[model samples]
Target: MSGLKKVIIPEMPPLEREMIALRIANMLEEGSYVNLGIGIPTLVSNWIEGRDIILQAEIGMLKSGPLAEEGQEEQDRINASCQFICAMPGSSYFDIETSFAMIRGGRMNVAVLGALQVSAKGDLAGWNNPSRGLGKVGNIGGSMDLAVGARKVIVAMEHFTPGGEPKIMSECSYPLTAKACVDVIVTNYAVIDVTPDGLVLKEAIPGVTAEDIQKMTAAPLKVAADFKEMEL
Candidate 1:
């Protein structure tokens, strides 16, 4: 998909996902066991490549890595997205049972996932958008398991859809993946924390005002007392 043309979205900056990816990666503490969902969350592996953070995949790989180059792809050693990857030192493998067990057993410290719509109450709906003809037969993979199983569920996605629709809403319009599962949301414009008081704006990118974010968002946002510009 390199050099791919994006004709539908022309308003947003091109490197938005990259910046958001790094921001989410930096939030992880050392030695945190993380399950990175597909899409933007997958890029986090590139950010934490050398650190001690362990990456887990529901497709039976652990201590995973970024996508392999064209000639290096190995079918047997692919990640959940079936993309070939290089295994890091001390990486391990298991059957599907134990793979999901790690997720369902609460062994994962963090689950970084992509989202479609996330409510202020932290309700998640990453799968199945009826408007897009996506939810019918089997898209719910390990997202639900990771959502409720992880100690912290951090969603990494664009702040809004390609058509300028807010993905962060007062309530999710899509089918529920998990209720109050998202703890943090990292987007192109701001970093938000889902709290008992609702979504709090933790940080905003430089030059992007809170009013800009509020206009793009569908729900009310609580500005954090320590709100500041994002370092990245």
Candidate 2:
């Protein structure tokens, strides 16, 4: 807060959700091997339409296709992540052992995941939001493993809950994916980077100012001097 100054929200023509996806897509690198988790993570692959990147799914496949065709989803050849997919030519399948081996062996460059809560300290909480269910809990799947194993862990999520609760906080109140594993967080409201000092507001969505974003977040955040709303 001390390093930030109040500024007007820039104008953005598109919806914040689309803006978030566009912003997250900018983080991808050529030739990087990546895994996209469900929800927002899935949308990222679609955003990277022409990028020459290799996609991996946790279920045990490499170079998976964007999304499955509308009526051509094959039950047998689906990626290990199981989001309903087709494989790219030359895409190969392996057993779960090899699949998890890629994740645990640090062969992955990045992993984009969806989170229910992420702390300012970079701890992730996507698997257990008690409010969403009773005795049964959310699935961690390979999220914990990927977050720890991958070189970069990017958390993609909407800025707030339907009830207007902030997803980024000073500390997570739910089950953790990993401590200090998240490198960045892309949300409908803002694009933030998790640093040792605090959450840095790198880009805010149009119609939302730095002050507005700070008010919405549970944790205190820092805004860059040249901060501006992301442009698609």
lDDT (10s digit) by residue, model 2, range 1-232: 1122233333444255555666778889988899888777877777787787888877878998876778987888665456578777789988888988898899899998899889999999888777666535667788888988998999989776665577788888777888999999888777889988888998876687888888878899999777887777
Best by lDDT: 1
Q: TM-score, each model?
A: 0.91, 0.88
Q: Candidate 1 on 151-174: residue-level lDDT in tens?
A: 999999987777557788888888
Each candidate: RMSD to true structure?
5.2, 4.7
Residue 33 of model 2, lDDT score = 91
Q: Worst lDDT window (10 residues) for model 2?
A: 1-10
Q: Over all chains combined, what TM-score does candidate 2 have?
A: 0.88
Cα shift from native, residue 186, model 2 (Å): 0.7
Looking at model 2, residue 22 earns an lDDT score of 68
Candidate 1 residue runs with Cα over 4 Å from true position: 1-15, 134-136
